[model samples]
Structure formats: C-alpha cells, structure tokens
Target chain A: MARTLITVPRTAKRDEIIEIRALVQHSMETGYRRSSDGDLLPRDLIRRFTCRFVPRVAANSNAASTAGDLIFAATFHAAIAANPYLSFNLRATTSGTLVFSWEGDNGLAQTETVSLLIA
Target chain B: MQPSTQALQKDDTQNPAMLWVKDGEALWNKPEGAAAKSCASCHGEISRMKSVATRYPAYSSTQRKVINLSQQVNLCRVTQQQASQWPADHESLLGLEAAIAKESRGLPISPPTQRQLADAQKHGEALFNQRVGQVDLSCRDCHETLAGKKLGGNVIPQGHATGYPIYRLEWQSVGSLQRRLRGCMTAVRAEPYTHGAKELIDLEAYLAKRAAGMKLESPGVRP
Candidate 1:
C-alpha cells in the first residue's frame, strides 16, 4: 500500500489561511541508475498530485449540484525526492472535504480524503 | 551535524525515514502469521513500548546470547507470531525497529549492566580501538581522534549510536546500526562481519553504553 501522511487543521475561522501538508511514500526510482548486475532499473515514480476542496452543500441546497474547487496540483519528475512531500496554503472559506490524489507510473493511483470545518 | 541536515531530521514531514516509521506503526497493529496475532494483540497500545529502546543489545535468556532490537523483533515473530525471520535490513524489519525506537525518542540511552551484556560491551570497545583491515585503521582513529575534521567532503562525527535506523542520504533509505557499521568496516577495507554477527552486536552494546544519557533520535536523517 502507498501510505500517506496529511496534516490539516480540524477547524479554522472563515477566510483564515491554513497550511496543509501531504507526504506520500514512493521509491521515485530514476531510470538512469543501473543495478549491481549492471542492468538499468526501470523508472518508477508518482507523476502527478492534486488537491481539491468539495464544499459542503447548505441544508436547503441541492447536494448533487455542489462543485469541487481545485486548490493545488503539481507534476513530479525524476528530480523529485523519494517519499515526496508537498505543503500548501489554503483559505478556509467553507466547510468541506479535501481530496488528495496521486497518479504515477505502473498504473499507480491513490486517493485520500479528510474533512475540515470552517467555523 | 550541519544545521540544514538537523532541520531535515526535526521535521517529520521532510524526513524520509518517517515513511518507515509509519509503515512500522501499521505493522504493529496488523495481524500476521498462523496465530494471526499483531504486536498490539499481546502488547496492547504502542505507547506501552515507550522507553523500551533505551535498553537494548540486551541479554536474552531464550537465545542465551546478547541481541539487538532487530533480533528481538525476529524472536517475537518466530515465537509469538510463528512467522519466518526477516532478513537483516529488510524494509519491514527496519520499519518495525524504527517505530519502536521512535517511542523512545528524547529518552537517554541506558544499556543494561547484566554480566553477559557487559562482556559484549567490553569486547566491542576493544574492537573499536583495535586496528584492522588493509588500511590498518581502527574506528577510533577517525571517529574518536579525528572527529569533526574533514575526510574528503564529509565530516566525521563522534561514533555515537544515538540516532539509528537512521535515514542516510547515501543509502537513500533507513538502515540499522549494524548496516552502518558494516559500511564503515568495508570503507576501511576490513573483512567486515556478516549481518547479525555477535561482533556487530558487541559493537552496538558498547556504543549504547558509550552514548549513555544521550537522547535517541531514531529515524534520524543524516547526510
């Protein structure tokens, strides 16, 4: 399993800027390196990361119509270190769930979600 | 240690070794082997293991020998979980060791004073001071006498085992104290002891005593 650690405030005041941190485990193996037997090690890495905020619908509003706002995204390359970590700032405008996903080589895809409350 | 490297170790998010610690935590609670028992099944909460790492390279009555944390882990796996022993420096082994040691973070190194452990420590001290290998240099020559001085591009820090299962940039992974010692012996062109060798355990025992009262920083990030 590709384990990940994420940090986000459990609750924040409206419009407050909060820091979010995400760390994911991966070898991020570069294709250039040769094995001890001199065979080239194939490249394996997480190629992309994205975080989106799915805003909570009001009691009277249509939940199905709610939309997710893209908060951050990045494209990782060979130069990125193993167990990549990314930290970003987000404005707490509404109560919502933050979705984090990673897509990578070898058909790797992982997604995790954490809830947040804006008081 | 350089300030930047120290900073890297201090932050959990930036430290790559923490990935192993996280894996270890998961392993602690997950069931394994025929009995389907996890470390938590018998040990209860992970917090129960706190301060346990401070006393290691301990004498084991069952094995009738001195063993380090990794050996103790294997013992539990075989005896309690009925699982096969993990090879030395295996990711799962390193992860479990890292997780256990992390619980003792900020606690002093407190090697036991049992007679068998004492013997191992003494032997280890002698080995540390003895000249060996093609270069005819002992560990003391560089880690003790020349510590803080430059050797090529790197500075030789005191040979303390305070932080282990350390995340060495060179290795690009978490490694045990035994693995690091083997690397050093090889660097000196010495016929290095095999993994889990008694001599290596002895060295680890002595280093534990040598570093007594120093705080542990397992899963340490090193340059």
Candidate 2:
C-alpha cells in the first residue's frame, strides 16, 4: 500500500467550508520510460481518488452504514507526479468521518479516515 | 526559482518533503541500537538545534577535518549510539538531515573561520576555481559569472547551499547538497568524489562560506 497523509479540521461551524488536503506516495511511472537494459518500464499510477463523509450514527442504529455522499473525486493519468497531492473544500453539514481512498495500477489501493466535529 | 516552486516551499502542506520530515520526527524519538539511545536522548528537543545546520561543514578537532551534518550524524550513530552508519542517500539519512535542516530554517549560513581551518578553506577555494573535465568549467564560470542569466530556459541560481535537502521537481524527492554538487560535476563531465570524501567536504566548506549571510531554507522546493 502507498503511504498516505490526510489533513482535515477536527471541528468547524455549521455550513462552513473546511479545507481538506491529502497526499499519497506512488511512482506514477509513465509507460514511456525505459529501463537500464532498454526494456520499457510499465506505467503504474494511482488512477482514482475519492473522498466521502459518513454522517454520525443515529441514536437507534447499532452501526453506521458504510456508504456516504461523495464529497470529492478525481481520476489521474501518467502525467501526475510521484506523490499525488490533492486539496479541496468541504461544506460541513454535521459531525462525521471523512474517508479518503485511492485506487491505482498494479492493484494499489489505500484509504484513510479522519473525524470532523460540527460546532 | 519559479513562482510555483517558491509557493511549494512556502506552503508546508504542498511540500512533498514534509512526508520525510514527518518520518524523521519519528526516527528522532525512537530508540534503537545497543545503547538504546535515540537522537532525542542526546540532542533533546529539536528546537535546541536551531541554527545548528548553518554552522556545519565546520572544523572537527576529533576528526582533524571538516565534516558536514550528515557525517556528524553518522559519527554519533557509530560512536555514541552504537549503530552502524547509514549508507549514502539512504532515506533514513535524508529524512534525518531534512528534519535537522528544517530546524535551522531562516537562519543565516555561517561557516567557521579559524586558523586551523584556513588551510582546508584555501584548498576548497582553489577547487572551486580550478577547471577540469571535458567542458573545463569552474564553479565560478556559471554560478559566479553567469548568475541571474537564463540558461536553457531556466534562470541560473548562484548555486548556494542555503536550500539543501531540497525537493527538486526533477528529482521528485528531497536530496542533500553533496548530491547536487555531484550532479553539477557530472553535468560538466567531471569525476565526482565519493560520498563522504574529504574533497567533497572541502567543497562543501567553501560553498558554505560563499553562502554566508544567506538565509537557510532546507527541505526547500525547487524546479
């Protein structure tokens, strides 16, 4: 799994747009490059990234559902550099957890979670 | 530097080298080796190391030579911490160097000047002026004479060491000043000294002196 870094505010006022930033370590190798022996290096990169917010569990619920509304998403290509860094804003509606996930070539997938509190 | 590169350096969140700095913070506090001592055990809080990087490539009486911060770290590892030396360009070494250099941010570069170091300093000065390799170009040719001029669509920087452990867009990673020097030598088709070699140390000393009074900006982002 690629190393990841995620930044999100712990608390924010209702309806405020909070900044969210994330970075993931990957080679993002383009297929055009050649190896020392002249063999072409295969392209490998994080192809997709998604962020969603899971709302606070209801009082009657035993567990919070896994699904949530998508906050942000991006599709990447070989042009992206080694570490894909992304920053975006989120409008706070309620206290919840922000889940970030990335999918890439060679079966690479990574996810990170951060909590957000509504004040 | 390009505006985009400068922006990356100014914003910690945008600087990719911050990832290594985070890793270095962990290594600083984590104990290892036979002595079970971490860098923190000796150096205490990293804040105490402020401006330390600027004073490096200074004379070391114990070694009877000038040594850079990376060499000092290795010396401490082997002699004090009872750990093996990290290989050249090792991620752990680069991480620790970046973390240490980060502490010295905004401080001025000030290499030592003492009677004993005068000879080594002279040697370094000579090396900087001497032309070699197929291109036969000296450091003065570009950095001193052609500074601020455009070359191959890129501005020629004075080639100061102020921003070492820099995140070069070309490298796509953080690297040391010595590594940059080696790259320059290779560009001129000159033979580069081995990592940790005395010649490299002397060159570093001279560069540090040349950059005196310049602000330190390690883990800097550059194009």
Q: Give the Cα error of residue B144 in candidate 1, in Å.
A: 0.9
lDDT, residue A69, candidate 1: 81
lDDT of 2 by residue, B1-223 (tens): 8888899899887788888787777789888789999999999997788999998888888988788899988888998899999988788888888999999999899877775566667788899999968999998899989999998999999888788888888988878888888999999999998898888888888888888999999889888
Residue-level lDDT for B215 in candidate 1: 94
Model 1, span B1-223: residue lDDT tens = 8898999899987788888999999999999998899999999988899999999989998899999999999999999999989999999999999999999999999987799999999999999999999999999999999999998888999989988999998777788899899999999999999999989999999999999999998879888
**Model 2: docking quality category:** medium
The candidates' DockQ values read 0.54, 0.56
Q: What clash count goes with each model? A: 0, 0
Best by lDDT: 1
For residue A88, what is the lDDT in candidate 2?
A: 98
TM-score, structure 1 vs. true: 0.95
Q: Model 1: runs farther than 4 Å from truth?
A: A63-67
TM-score per model over all chains: 0.95, 0.93
Model 1 chain B: which ten-residue window has the lowest total lDDT? B167-176
lDDT of 2 by residue, A1-119 (tens): 56677878789999999899998767799999999899999989788999989999879988777788898999999888888799999889889899999998899888888999999
